[model samples]
Target chain A: MLMIKTVLHFDSVSFRYPKQEKGPLIYDSMKFTVREGEFVSILGPSGAGKSTLFRLITGLEQPTGGKILLNGEYFSNRLGHVGYMPQQDLLMPWRTIWENAALPLQIKGSKQADMRISVEELLKEFGLGGHEDRYPAELSGGMRQRVSFLRTILTGSQVLLLDEPFSALDAITRLSMQEWLLKQWEKRKKTILFITHDVNEALFLSERIFVLTDPPVSRMEDIPVPLDRPRTLKALDIPEIMVLKDRLIDQLRTKATT
Target chain B: MKKWREHTYSFILLVVVLVLWEAIAFNIKMTFILPSPTDILMKLWELKKVLLLEHLPATLCIILIGLGISIILGVGLAISMNSSKIIEKAFYPLIIFSQMIPTIALAPIFILWFGYSIWSKVLVTVLITFFPITINTYDGLRAGSNDLKELLLTMGAKKKDVFLLVNVPSAMPHFFSGLKVAVTLSVIGAAIGEWLGAQAGLGYFSRRMMTQFDGAGVFAPIIVLSAMGIMLFLLVKWVENKTLMWRKSE
Candidate 1:
């Protein structure tokens, strides 16, 4: 088997909020690597700087020290280098499903005709084929998340950062959304960095889990799942998977106590 | 059906008030001091040619023209304030202070400057109408999601794109609400401007009728003005409903 290329690399990154110069650092000499075509979940409790990591990668915030490499190259400005799906769907109430999905293309100044084709194809693949004309208010929560995910994919970036995309959905919907997301990831073969607090969700979806135990986070524990491909929800009950789930919860509990 | 019920209730209340006024006026036999509803109606019919054809049109023109200008000015100011903190700080207090300066006081200055020309009336209408639009649009611009703005930024969006896609669309509901308020105030502005000085307008017509002790004549123009105000208000509401159908569903 051939070795996979490293699509993203963080070289001893350090960061603290600019305004809070004297405040505690959020990240200190943090280093990690995500290989190509990986579905890696960043699992941490709230306030563990899970979002700060994504923000740094997206270039919304800068790291005071360290190098961030995308595709084995460092760029000071990382905006547009990666796809990001925020916590809220953040759909424009005025825009219809197709229009919302076409936003990244519009920003890139794609022709209207070109936008029509790309958005149409993606809408169908995302199971939103006939709902393109509907406003955000008309769609259910799960459907809205799909539209948002379509928009994220249209950014045309190799790496995607999803910040708890289904935290607000009902349990039933969230489970389906996870399975659907995993299918999309496999089909597209893009590197995905999913942020979630749910240990079981991390186990169910990602090939590997990066547990952010605490911040100022110096390191993340990289652990591989022992599960096979094309996972069913029933696979969650496997003895090894259950042990990993318990271990993740234990890490989160330790953070909570501190 | 519920709306029809509301209209019937309003109609009955109006008829009851008018019948009571007619009974009192009939007993006193004084058309000047207290004109009956029928007397006012007859006077309105007699003056229809003048009010509808000339003075009514004049006032409506001032309102519509002033309203159009005010909308352009208001949206411009709101956008400027949103784009720059300095502009917002400088103009915000000035706008509030300007409102404190009553139209009764400002009307004289405009009349002195523009004389009896339509400009003076339009100026007054702009003064009255633009406030709501400016304040509401400013608030609406700020009300858009920061997350949305950031999302766009991460997608390589320019400031212009963020403004057009997120800020402008999000501000629509507030802008429409402000417009409804502005349109209603516009009628009042035109009347005040005309009251101070004008060649032809409903306010001028009413004043002239009052001096001649034609009570029903004064009442006639007042009714026309009130009806004009209602029509303009309803027109704004209809446009708002059409533009923001999404708002109605949520």
Candidate 2:
């Protein structure tokens, strides 16, 4: 078996917002690791500093103490190594779907003709083939999310961070999007760090789940999903998976109370 | 079909208004106090040669030149002001203060300084038109989402890329709205400047007609000036429609 290398490591990271210097620290010596090609979910309630963690990892904000390592190298507050999809679609209303998806490439200074050709194929694969020239206002919520996702992927980063990308969708659409994302993940094999409050989603998609306590997260528990590969909706009913789900819910409830 | 109906309704209303004016002029038995629409139209036809040869071109040139300068300077100032908080704080109050001083007050000063040439009129137009563009563009630039900015930053985008990609496009609607207001004011600005001092223009022509008590002649230039204002406004609207197709409703 090939050895799995650590793609990202959080070495006892600590952070406190500058405005609230005297307040409790947001991250108290937090530590974790994501292996190469792994799908991990950070499951926590709202205001658990989950977004703050992403901010630190994405280099939008620097950690006050400790360090973050990407591929065994010190990662500072610098962008471009990781792709991020914010909560909102954030598509430029003035741009067509094709133009919006090709933004990262444009930012990287790729030739327009080449960028269009490449983005066209990606749009087709993502079920946005005929909608390339359409404005964002014309697209449905799911289609817009797909375009945003395609834009994130086009950034060409090996590590992807998704911040509640489907929280805005209806239940039916969210399920379909989850299934589609799982398929995409299996095919791409990118290291994904997903942030969500949905336990079922975390269970269905990720190989491992990190349950974080409320803000000033003093502790974190990592639980592995020992399920078969190429999962389906049927996997949700598996006896062991149900047990794990109940366990996660209990942990979350307890954390909320305490 | 709906748009055509609306236009047809507008034409009927205009015809009714014109007939009413003609009735009133006939009852009064005087062309000076309220000239009939036909009298105005006939005067316009008689002065068409002078309008085309001299006044029309003069006014058009001043307005176009003033508008062009305003757009360039306005957008440039907006970009610089948005780029830094200190610069914005220093200049924002001064911009508002400039607006408070009526253009009428400044027109004579501009004439005194620049002389009775086209420069004074153009300068007055610039003074009136640049404010809307600058203020609207500034508001639009600042209205860009912080989330989007952070997303771009994470993509390793440079400061220039963020401004061009996010800021400029977001400012389009606001810029167009400002332009619509500015273009209408530009014609008025030119008229005011010409009222202060000028060798030739629709304003100069109108003043000459008014002093001579040639009511029909005065009405003729006023008609031409109104037409000029409408044409310039429509031109701006047409450009805005073409460039901002994204703003169209679904």
Candidate 3:
């Protein structure tokens, strides 16, 4: 039997605000893992610690207890080890699309010539071929998100954390973006941990859905979707999938009380 | 059309006011007391060569040099404050306190220290004008939340990288706003400094005319100085528009 490689692991991690402001612990001895090239969606309701988990992963907030391992090795500093795509399409207003895409490379001090060539290729691949000269305001919502994603990818990390990346888009645009993201995940083979509140979005995108039920979330109910590869919206219409979706939704709704 | 109409109204108001002043001056019949609009205008025309070529240039020289120094110092101070919380905590209150003491009160001290030279006038300009630049740019630097900086930091960005990418660009709009205020104040600062003590400059020339009871002559330099201030302000505005062109395009 071939053993899957765990690309990221939260080893008994715990976090509470240093101020201890009003609430119980946000997370108590939480643990999770992402396998190489696997896409995982963390499903939860609003005001849950989903984005906070990403922040800990990104080293914006440090864990009070336990180690965050990347590729089975712990680094004291976890920053720049993963690509983080925030919910907002935070394309710099001052930069053209090309310059925005080139930002990560520029920040990392890559050679200007190499940065230009690489940025050009990524721009073309991302379907931003001729629109490089335009500013963020000129682009549609979907296009701006794509540029944002392209910049995240340029961070040159094997792991990517997407925080509600498609929540702001319209329904049609969100579906298309989901499909595009899935395709990109497969092509890039990067380990992805996506955060979303939408149950359908979680089901459509992930091989596994980790349900973050409530605060002081020591454990998440990790449910494997058991779907075949290269999924479609049509795949979700099956009766068994419907049953699972309803069960998950019911679990989500009542979990707050429990 | 509405804006054009408003400007025309202002022009008509000025004409009415000047006519009233002319009528009043004729009634008073005191050339030394309140010169008529026509008399002031005539004196302005006659003194055009001296005012424009000599006094105007001297005043312009002081304003330009003083404003230039203020720009450099203001940017440096703003950046220094932005880079560290400790510096901000220490200097921010001091900067505010410095503004409390009047620039007129400070001008005499500058003259006492630097002794009626260009340096004294420039120092006074800097004192009056640098505060706006420092405070506004500092506020602009602090405008964005830590999210953007953290975003860059997660990309393996060093301190310099973060400053270049986020801090600098974010502060630019605020910097320009401060600059517009500073440019207008710079004219007042320079003139005041020259007023307290100077052989040349519009302020000195105007004061000299007043002592001689040449009311029209005093008013002539006043007009020249107003023109200078308006011109400087417009120039600064044009530069601001050019530099922040991205803001408008968006």
Question: What TM-score describes the B chain of model 1?
Answer: 0.96
Which structure is stronger by lDDT: 2 or 3?
Answer: 2
Provide TM-scores for the models: 0.97, 0.97, 0.94
Model 1, docking class: medium
Instruction: Residues A73-117, candidate 1: write the lDDT tens digits.
Output: 999989888999998899988888899999999999999899988
lDDT by residue for model 3 over A1-258, one digit each (tens)? 999999899899989877775657899898888899888999988877899999898887888888899999998888888899999888888888998988888877788788878888888998999988788898999999999999999988999999999999999999999999999989998889999989899999999999997888898889999789889899998998999999989987887556
Per-residue lDDT tens digits for candidate 3, residues B1-250, read 8888879978999999999999999999888779998999999999989988889989999888987888898888999998888988999999999999987987888888989888898888889899999998888888865777888878878888888888888888998889889988988888898889998999889989989999898898989888888988898889888887667757
Residue B56 CA displacement from its true place in model 1, Å: 1.2
| Pairs that collide, model 1 | none
Q: For model 2, state the Cα shift of residue B62 in Å.
A: 0.8
Q: What overall lDDT goes with each candidate model?
A: 0.92, 0.90, 0.88
lDDT of 3 at A245: 96
Best-to-worst lDDT order: 1, 2, 3
Which CAPRI category fits model 3? medium
- The superposed Cα distance between candidate 2 and the true structure at residue B170, in angstroms, equals 0.6
